[model samples]
Target: MSNDRVGFSQPQPEPDRQALGERLKEAREYMGLKQEDVAKVLGIPRSALSNIEAGVRKVDAIELARLAKLYQRPVAWFTGEDPEATSEVAKEVAHVARAAATLSQQDRQELARFANFLKSRAKAKATPDGR
Candidate 1:
């Protein structure tokens, strides 16, 4: 056999770093958190945070996770895996889910019933005759 390598060796391109930075910046702004405050929480310098937001530096997994927690977002949000990251309703649902996790089974059942009732009310309002 000839001594030749026959395999795809090119590494895949990384995700858009600038877009990631912009999303991080947007999340911070949405939470009304200043960069210095967020940086302090992450135990990094403000300039480091600035560089991260500007896409001049990369954010590692730990830093991203910390930012997610600080911003009340899922880690998937920063990674662009969550399509509903920017949706207010989705955020509310996530918040509710987190709260539900701590509830007793009976409480969860009541919450589900309450949600169904609200859905029925909304559906009734949508009818032409407000049925």
Candidate 2:
């Protein structure tokens, strides 16, 4: 008689934002720090860390750097800016862009108009001095 378990699950094709969130949470927990402890380590509030871990809030570069220092992890761990993530998102974006590039001149003009609108909206949300 023997007891064994083995099977290769199909790989997930998309970025798992939720699992990524949980992985960050688990890493924090493994460091033996509660949310408040992590907040204190980064000199922020518990609510901030809680919101971040819950994926309700986005993290900026500085905050990402602080988290990296506190967690004793490399900055790439938080930014997902490592080679792997960069290559993955880049490839997907390139795929979409190349397909769009085949559009006619008028279609490209309309797309540019929409992209400009989005850019303006993003700028409006920036700091007064303009980030």
Tens-place lDDT digits, model 1, residues 7-28: 5332332457777888899888
Clashing pairs in 2: none
Q: What is the C-alpha lDDT of each candidate?
A: 0.82, 0.66
Per-residue lDDT for 19 in model 2? 46
- How large an RMSD does model 2 have? 17.1
True-structure RMSD for candidate 1: 13.6
Model 2 lDDT tens row, 86-129: 46765675465566667888997898799889888899778696
Would you estimate the TM-scores of all the predictions? 0.56, 0.44
Each candidate structure's count of clashing pairs: 0, 0
Candidate 2 clashes: the total is 0
Over 4 Å off, model 2: 1-20, 81-131
